[model samples]
Target: MTWETGGKSEEPDGAGRRDPAPPPVGGILWSVAGDIRVLLTLPSALTMQVAHPAVGAGVDTYSVFRTDPWGRGERSLRSAQLWVYGGEEAAEEGRRLRRLHRTIQGTDTRGRPYHALMPANYAWVHATGFPVFRHASAYLQRRPYTPAEERQLYAEWLRVGRILGIHDRDMPQTLEEFWPYYRRMLAEELELTAVADELTSVDRPVPPPDRGPLALRLPLRLLWPVLFPPIARFRRFATIGLMPPDAREAIGLPWTDAQERRLRALGRVVRVVVPLLPERLRYLPLARRARARARRPG
Candidate 1:
């Protein structure tokens, strides 16, 4: 009736299976970091939706439910209500979604429809399902929620059920529904990015002279070493099969030209500087040198 790991033990369920350990804080941190990366790289319009207050609130509510479903009590009900009204921002978001939907509805270029561009809008049901189940399991295991939180969580669950066209009586009692939702959400994010890019291109024009200071544009020189390596690795990992042999003749990884130039510049700098430094100072000094080079005027 007990499960043990790293000398820690907890009671097992009646079925005699031990409970899985809680996910490490590191994984949660990494997940947030990945979300940030995706947000930054995505198109402004798509990123705006993810950053919306309502969406953020939903994600927070979802995370809390996943982490401690029973603990949500009254807070869970509040979250559900918030979601129902789409928070204070729903009207604007609804307008944007409608406009985006219209923009993309029949505009598929390669046999894929415009609706494909707003994938995330249609993925709401899937996006909310997994955390609900995951947290429900945790709630059963830990019994940490006040009665109020449990009620609220259930309220939110009921609302989600309605939105997704799930019958309260027929809602999934297990985790089988979670995976499909996650996949659909990811696919929607990809499609949304493509659509956003198209919108940006169509709207491009000269900026006003008094448009004022840029926000979030750190000097690329200062950011290069700190930002480029991980970005390069991520690009490589994400694009393993991005191009077919035939397509490579006409198109390639979007970064092929820029990446080649940066890598060559990096290599040239490394070749000239590495041997000049003392062996003891090489690794540490190399970073400083890279930073310095990044700051230099072209």
Candidate 2:
């Protein structure tokens, strides 16, 4: 019923197995998940995640996304970065998320009860990232990952799910199982949830960044109305455009061919531009630090 590591005894996972640790460093996930390009597709992943009824309800009710969007996003990004690059801290972050979600329970808009920790909901949230990553990679990279690379990426993603406390039973164990499961959820479970709609709405009001020094924050607030329209449009574009086509269709979001062409053009630019940046600029802060540490004499 318990497993031990680092002098700590932890409860067995949903499959009655020992805790599945984070994906190994220098693995597929390390190379993929921590890249700055992931930020471009993150909105799509978040949108897909909340399209599930329970996740949407929990987020609509308990999340501070409306009031503190920047802070909430920063924290989410930080947690994601920590999962890939934090070493021992990655498992602790996983535990922290599980603990944080324990209280996220409520009735969804359909009057059905839901909880964040419900295995299906938890697993679905973790599952969305894989497809989105693969889809977005086509545009963000010179080419999408090859079949073998996708298999490796999916395996690595499964380990990341374990780090988030998802059971092997709750999620499809391999790519063959995963696509069917993903399609079934898209057909039967996913919806245009209220939260999903709002997240993808271009007109949705978002405040200026409030994190930095007051001097800069004040000017940003004054300039935000002028600055936000294009940003909001791009956010909406990326959220809807980056989703797998099946998922977009299932949720009734439209994707025009023109938009697809534009997205590809932008992706082409990103592919050319991103790799030219130095590591400090290319990777997120945590990943950058981790790479620096790995390069040190040891």
Candidate 3:
């Protein structure tokens, strides 16, 4: 959440001049469960300036340093190296690794200093681990990070990036580029729960038909109705402020002067529709059924 960039300098001629900060150099950091992954991007030169001195000095200084995944001790360098190198190929691998790392680490959408936990937990569940079960359990428990711990993790990310030949000037932009991949990974993980529910349902047993016509047709048919109403609603609400300005801006869908008028018109229609629809029917029945079945005892 705390994005830093290079510092600016004062100008002469009475028109205040400023210098833009350098881009982030790639770096590595530790997860809450104490695994090292690259940071890939950082905000300010000052931030990295503060963190640069401690790379590889010892486990205590490194963020990803932990004796074991859940062990309450400093991590060994071997553990950090293992986490960095696992199943990775070496060509521009640091950038790819950092992108994957951020997707799992989750960002502070609200611009907070620390990363969020839920997404990290989701990532840990899917990623193969070194000390496997111990790391997984730490994620499940949602442990909080101490101030020292946060700084340490940040430092480790920077260190790893340096080792991999990632330069400081290229760090921030590199991380931004990698953001999309993280989002895709999170979306894919969410889709898995839906798949699991469908497979386990007794009433909705899998069809024995070969993967042919029925397979192609059923999903399309099922999705068509589900999408139509929402699309209609979104179009109707398009002129209204269906989403907050900041949310739209964060996702790069900033409103224009024309969009403001459209949003207002859409809002008006959505307000009218809300009261007309039954509460139970507001959500799609398919989604509701899935939720209901998920909660049922085995």
Candidate 4:
């Protein structure tokens, strides 16, 4: 059987009916995922995906990440927000990604067959969210997560994992279970493929997001290209700081005394400053739209 969404069709199981998509992450998930500060951890999360050999191979073969870095990153981030907060839109995005990935299976450079749909690759992507929730909460709140909040946040990400086609049985159930798996993957599975290094090094400038107002937009457009290189440089250091020591070492990204100092200072500035803006300015407008949609899910 087949399902239609976003003008694309997907094959389902022999039964015409489909498993219902999980509810959107709310309560704890929204509180954590909604903050723009969560973006601070994005570089770390992204590098983790490509560190897996299959993920690296699939990205190089299938994605336009290098040639159009900003567009690729923006599209992926929008898809993620849709998956997390788009309600039925989230479900459709799930099927959409699943369909796109179905054709991406092939052999890697060393003669290993790799499919993007496999549990391990998806699981690794899901696992990156653990640190995102951990640090976002800590950074925004100026404190560590209590054990209960960590467990709840981990559980919420597992639902997100399901939406992304990861099976529940293949995922860790708690924060405690997550760390060991994360460490093991960092130690044994991650590698700095050429594509990944190029990705981490960042070949192009990142453009600013679409903020309303010609006034704001005009100045940002003129200024952003000028500031982007320094911002990109800071992103590299920030990525290193967020990563586990083993992962950064394996990936061959440098973390120097100067970078460490800059990263800490950067964190202090963003953590202290971003949340003080009026609530409307504090997060993405797309998140607000998605959140409203999630609440009214059919």
Candidate 5:
């Protein structure tokens, strides 16, 4: 995607001009992330990432991925998305992220050397994003991605990886090559880790439902405890269903007959309800802004 910004010199500190609508990581990347329920895919993505021995070891040692799991996940993902479409803000945050990971190299549980910045490790992290986008897009729309769109989506996401410093040589060049490589990694590289199990457990409280009018708040406060466990259970079940059976087994999240039944019913419910939302209401604010910016006349 050729960027054609006007001859520009106004960027602060001569940071230079960046395309507000960079094609590689725009559109589908923001659209997919904009889905409110995309949060469901987090445990699954994180589980897949940390299953790599080096990723697991690095995260366990230098990251707050466990102690402040939700906060850490939110900040890290926000940065990644910002890097894709937030222009200079993305660049600044990306640098901070690179600086943070600079010291995150050491040995894994097996005493093998590892570095978070290694192309291989960063690619492992980037690889997980594709499936998260795929599943969320599929579930929200009750539609599958066309082959062309899938490849396009992968291509776009690759630019995002590059922004975060993942090396091109370490990434699959096309969607055709990705699944096979992903499967091979699962067979050879993914392993169960205690942190992965803890993430999948999903026994924690979700964000509060309402923080507005006292009328709404009072009832939500009363009902939240009663409602949270079943909601969390369903989310856990849906996340487990997203992964292949072997991967689930590797992470020690057992799928049961009851979970399968509930998950299917939940999927049906989501398909029916989500599309009924007004298009404006269906996506996140960032997605709306990105879409609006993309459509503006050059």
Candidate 6:
């Protein structure tokens, strides 16, 4: 395949100082990243992200994943939506993320020093999403994206990477370059860090989701004992089941043939049902609003 700059900005920056442009309205990422269907596969993407030692270390040290898992996931999902659908807000969100991570440095379990902003670590986190979406689309999407669409999608993801402060040098610029890079990372860099283990472990201790109005919280707290087991089991299932098989093996995640069959069955239902929902229900609130604005006669 010929190398194509899918992520290159169409507009020239004369001063070479302008912030990277956000994914365009009606672009591949604008549609894919903002859809509610993405939630089905995001756990797997996140699990793959933390499989990198530096990222896992940073998350273990600084993230509230354990204590505030719901809030943490919600914020992450919202930030991702902004990157594709928040228009001008997308570039600001990216800068804000850099500022947030500026102070997040620590030593990994292996005693290697790591910083959250390290290009390789940050890029690896961004990179994991592409493959997960590609792989999981077979199950979650009504139809898997065609080869041309895949190229377009990867290119859009790279553009989003720039928004997150990742330079082109740190990420592959084309689909042809990306596959080799992705395989190399899987073969050489990724492993099951402690955070990855817990994320995919059924027995891991996860507190009841503790945010929301008191009225909502009280019932959820009371029902948590009954509600949490299925929720935890499903999280573990989705995280492992939706992961690319190569990455799953690289990270040493266990998966049975039976589980694969079940995951596929679930995906089929999601593909058929999710697309049938109306826009307000099918898309996240941020995406719903932005898509409406994009369609307005300007």
Question: What TM-score do all the candidates reach, one by one?
Answer: 0.27, 0.92, 0.22, 0.81, 0.78, 0.91
Tens-digit per-residue lDDT, 35-95, candidate 5: 6566666667777888888888877776665455445555655665575557556555544
Give the clash count for model 4. 0
RMSD of each: 20.3, 5.0, 22.8, 4.6, 6.6, 6.1
Winning candidate number (lDDT): 2
Off by over 4 Å in 3: 1-241, 283-298
Whose lDDT is higher: candidate 2's or candidate 4's? 2
Residue 188 lDDT in model 5?
78
lDDT winner between candidates 1 and 4: 4
Tens digits of lDDT, candidate 4, 153-219: 6777777777776777888877677789888887877888766676567454455745457678778
**Which residue runs does candidate 5 get wrong by more than 4 Å?**
1-26, 202-228, 296-298
Q: Return the lDDT, model 1, position 114.
A: 31
- What lDDT would each prediction earn against the true structure? 0.32, 0.83, 0.30, 0.67, 0.66, 0.82
Tens-place lDDT per residue, model 2, 1-298, is: 0000112225432444455677777887888777899898889888888888888888888888898888788888888887788887777777767767776798987788987888888999889989998999899866878999999989988888878888789999989999999999999888999988999998889999989788899899999999999999999898888889999998888899999999999998999999999988899999988888888998
Runs of candidate 6 with Cα error greater than 4 angstroms are 1-16, 212-214
Among all windows of ten consecutive residues in candidate 1, which has the lowest summed lDDT? 1-10
Consecutive 10-residue window with the lowest summed lDDT within model 2: 1-10
